[model samples]
Target: MATRRYLQLDVFAARAGTGNPLGVVLDADGMDTASMQALAAWLNLSETVFFVPMQDPAADYRIRIFTPGSELPFAGHPSVGAAWAALDAGLVDADARALVQECGAGLLPVRVEKTADGKRTIELCTPRRQALSTPPVAIPASLQALAAADAAPVLWSNGPAWWLLRANSAGAVRAFAPDFAAIAAFTNATDATGLVIFAPEAGAGHDVVVRAFCPGDAVNVPEDPVTGSANALVAAWLAAHAALPHADGRYVASQGRELGRDGRVQLRVDADGDVWLGGEVQPVIRGSLDW
Candidate 1:
């Protein structure tokens, strides 16, 4: 039997077993594509991240993210989780300000932020581009499978994928019971592997609330706990449409309450046209893989 090491971390959650869980293969430097895909399928998390050394000093490492079936261009939770795993294990030094994570999408910056607790939070910067003038004119038929009588879907993107639905009321958002099979079919049909459903938050503390689902890749389940990227994209889309109250600073989105995995993510948008997403990743399992 061949022995390999892997680290599992619970991302976008303050504690373990709550947020979107991710598996990282530390010895993935020499593994081929077929092996990576097989390992991802075996781990069966939202995504599995593999690291390869890069020659450029500008970038510390080459990171690739994969689901059970295929590789992904970009993803928020896995990026956060993988970076956390790399740093926490002392694989990447602390002094690095910016490390370019090379993925299918291209080289993206993973900027490190120091938290109050002395831990690090990595914000993956998205490529600068103009937001689409308008969201999808109407909800797609697949999204309509989860739609209510009052609200339809809105298509928006940041990096990974765009949210397809935006409800008219808090009740409408909460009442959406998605058809996972239909969602899977829809995902297979489009480049988007995930979907975001949202509406205004009911309480006064936050601006809005939302839920995320990624049936195409990891955890073929519905309602991801905390989604920083989706919320950031949503916030940007909202800002473009002049819907949100604040023009600057960070916004927090809370999700996964209905699905039992309560989580939160903070999104920061600066005047310089840069978006920052922050979340916590807790190391859950330190184990090995024998094949």
Candidate 2:
């Protein structure tokens, strides 16, 4: 009924149109929750972000994240995409070198690092880690059949709930064809977003290669080109259990090769054990929405 401005963003992309796509609906104030959910379902992307004036007094702006199926308390790519969209709309300034984001998870601090070319890298502080129960036998067996890693599947949450499985090599992660039926059953039983399979070292410019798979009954996203929250969980777990060999407390991770998209996520663990997940965003389409 009215015109609104929005941005289509590519998160964690090394190039345009190669990263995960996000729709940031700005000027979305007064839009009812049902309308927002309907629009998100219509958009049919992994997730859509809606921005409005701050509800929390401490936050500069408040954002709501919705997938086609349901709403999420927090999401990585949407947070990054929202940050870029907010910056573009003058909702935030970099004077303090940080941005605070308020969502279902609470207030999160985001670091703003600007490059020489005026491109900015935004690193959002992930919520404290929440380690959940282990995966069922079938889940581990499913991954074992494809790869030779014995590492058990771990379910954890930084924002949205997740399950992580470790493979022996990055090649193993790349070559496997997922059994979505079995995986969906596992997800149903465990209430996790999906499975994230990763290896210690791989890729040309990254320390680790991660592949995320989300299988569902009807509307399913077989693979996520880039996932911020999953990698954040990985960083927290590894920092606590097994430290990386060359870790200067920060490293770059690669993902999305299965989808032919070169996506990179920069994860850092500060001396205080805080995990920061970040990436560069590229605006693919800048326009106004009328609907």
Candidate 3:
């Protein structure tokens, strides 16, 4: 057993507690996978990340992400939170504007920048997207009411897989009550991580609203407060279908309201059609882990 630096962070938070929480363990170089998984299960957050020394020359650091039940190739909130933790722990140069993260999905680029109000923000460039022609499993009848009239459900993969659907309105997204057992069964059968539904908002401060329901076979996270990767895939779907509500291919996503958290995710699709996810991260706890 050894002591390791640990941080609890709120990613994509509009404030201190209104975002998804992530547990991060630093200097996790020698910890075996079983040990790491045990620590993650004990933490019981939606996801926990272990920061290890860089395994690839191109990366500033490497991270292993785990849920209470299993590990993931990549996850959005964990990636964003891990980047902030790396900077806060002095593992990366304070002045560095960018970083490369090595994870099971491979090397992903991260950008550090200051918001117009001068608050620091972190953004991750998602991997190339893979869209499935049809959902691996049929959409459950229970969720059919939430579907938008004009859009058909699509499945997208960027390390983790999610079935993307358009909702009729932001209110619908917020008001949705999911059937955890059915959703879990669908995800497990489809080999997917979760399902995401999004809708464009008109007068709200944010451009869209999104909700993710991920009930894995091993763990049951009924709804994610905020999800970066799902939102990225939504952006890709919108851009590819010429359905971008915003002319600039940039929009803010509102999430977490149903769970009593307020999360805002910034999404931008560049001219080359690459999607980037950005948001503010807040440190909630700093301590050490003994494992």
Candidate 4:
């Protein structure tokens, strides 16, 4: 058996145990797709990352993201965590401000900025065709099973894979008691795999609070800790369409409150139409795999 090594880290968090966790396969140059899927199932986390060092000078690297069920073209938290892992591994040069990652979806740039701690921060390019979907005048009969009907539904996305929905209030988000079988049926019916519902903060000093759920995978549960990139894309979409104020200002997002592992994520949308999601990460466990 051949042994493979990987690093484990928590992302989109200020501290440990507060954010989404990821397993990063540091040297996946030879691993195949079937192997990756099996490996993801073995990890049993939300996502697993595999880094394939690129030989081409023009490319920074390549990454493969996989859930337990299948591979994904792109994912927000894993992108950030993977870039940080690459930097920590010295895979890319310090002066390399931009990284081009070739994934299943396509080639996307992972922009990097150096922090005072000598770590590089990563921001990924959102998909060009992010959707703008508004709920019907009356709540759809299909979604009536969701906890709150009074809240408005706004849909958007950063990547081709997921459609994010922003709801009206925090209570509405927390009260979501979904029927997995029904939700899965709906996803297949509509060709949507994931849904994120959020609400505006009730008080000052907070920007927005949200919850993310991906039903395509087994158990069909919402994530305990979701990263800020998807939310940043949603915010960008909202600012563009709704004319929301402070769209250019730095925003704070609170997630995972419903699951008791509350997390804070920072976001900034630039004038150039680029969105940035920033957060800290910490290493939790490390191990190897046999293939």
Candidate 5:
């Protein structure tokens, strides 16, 4: 068995341990797809990344993103996490401010910035198409539809489709209790990934609070602490409704508190309506995978 270097990371962490966890295979050179799937299941994180060399000269690297259940076209945390790992591993030039990442969704750009305090932040430019889907047929007919009157129920997608809904307040969003059975049924019937709910935040720093849930079927995670793609959809929805004011097209999103995670996702809406999601990643565990 070849030894593969692995890194465990906490993405969007406000602190060292508070964020969405990811398992990154630093050098997945000859690993097969099935093996990677099994490895991801063994790791059992929200997602994992396998870094491979990019054949295209324009791309700095290529990443394969996987969930416990299946490989994904694209995911937010893995991109950010992988970017940090790429830099941490000295795989890319330290002074490069922008790098292209080729994934299942195609090549996307990542912005790297180092703060004055020595914290590194990475942001990924969202895919060109952000979808606002109508209610899916998978939702059980008997199930009570959940959505804020103001926000309505919107299925948003940057890569994987997430049912982006809204609650009246941050309290409701945090306090929401879901019926997993119904969610399971919904996911089985549709290709959509999961649900992401949000509400207006309290205090000053953040504009919205978020919680993500995926019923077992396509994906088994019940609640995701911090989600990058979901927040991008949320930002798009908010921008359309004028729900959250984006001064200079920048907004802060608060998530993962319900699961005891303190995650902060930073969003930037470019003048061209492009949404960029970013945050700091905390490297918690580093080791090797003997598989």
Candidate 6:
């Protein structure tokens, strides 16, 4: 057995323990797919990432993301956490402001910067946003009951697909108690990663409240504390529908409070219609893994 570096990080958190947790294995060059899958299952987080050598010269690093049950082409928290891990491990230049990540979805650009308060933040540019033409899946009765009458559900793809819906208010989003089985069934039937419900918020520190349920066949996560991809898609949906509350096309999303965690995600839809998602990543644990 060889020893490898391991990092546990909280992604999109304003503080420690307030974001989605990710497991990262560094220098996992020779690890086979089965071994990576086994380790990810053992970690039992929403997703675990294995940092491998770059396959493309343009990429600064390559990562393989896995959930407990299966592998994903890409994921938000994992990508953010892996980038932080890479910087912390000296895999990339400490002062580097940009990086290109190679994954199943392709090479994605990442930006590292500091907030005005001097807090470190990482933002990732997601794949081209696509509103799929597939007929909308029937929303579960529970979700349908809570959905906003003014907005219809939409299916969005940016590597992982999500069913996006709007709620009447932030309170409704926070009070939403999902029927996991029913939602899971819906996601499976629609071949989506999860169902995301969000609502606009005012004077609440954040501009939007978001929640993601992923008890689907693709992954084992029940409630994702903070989801990067879903938030990105939400931003795109808002922009496309000309529903952006902010004229700047930027918003902060509040999530995970229903699960006793407070997660914040930063979202911006550029003039070119590119969605960028990012937030603070707090390092929780750094240790060695025996494999």
Q: Which stretches of model 4 miss by more than 4 angstroms?
A: 53-57, 94-97, 114-120, 132-157, 202-205, 217-224, 243-249
Each prediction's Cα lDDT score?
A: 0.69, 0.81, 0.87, 0.67, 0.83, 0.88
Could you give candidate 4's per-residue lDDT for residues 1-291 as a string of tens digits?
667777899887667788888999987878888988888888788888998766556567778888776677777778778778877777877577887766665666777777787755567665453665543334335454443454344455555334455564567667776555655655544555466666567444457777766665531334536855457666675566553336455677788766667677666667777676666667777777776
lDDT tens per residue, model 5, 75-104: 899998988899898889877789898898
Give the TM-score of each candidate.
Answer: 0.84, 0.94, 0.95, 0.83, 0.94, 0.96
251, model 3: CA deviation in Å?
0.7
Model 4 pairs in collision: none
**Total residue pair clashes for candidate 4:** 0
Give the C-alpha lDDT of model 1: 0.69
Model 5 stretches astray by more than 4 angstroms: 132-146
- RMSD (CA, Å), candidate 1 to true, equals 3.5
lDDT-better candidate, 3 vs 6: 6
lDDT of 3 at 190: 81
Clash pairs (backbone) in predicted model 6: none
What C-alpha lDDT, on a 0 to 100 scale, does residue 229 get in candidate 3? 84
Among all windows of 10 consecutive residues in model 2, the one with the lowest summed lDDT is 213-222
RMSD values, in order shown: 3.5, 1.9, 1.6, 3.6, 1.9, 1.5
**Over 4 Å off in model 6, which ranges?**
115-119, 135-137
Local accuracy of candidate 3 as per-residue lDDT tens digits, 1-291? 688888999999968999999999988999989998998888889899998777799999999999888898888899999988888889999768899999999999999997788667999988878986564567888678889888888778998888898988888887888888899998888878889999887646688889999986644588988998899999998898897878898888888888999899999999998898989999899899799
TM-score (C-alpha, index-matched) for candidate 3: 0.95
Best by lDDT: 6
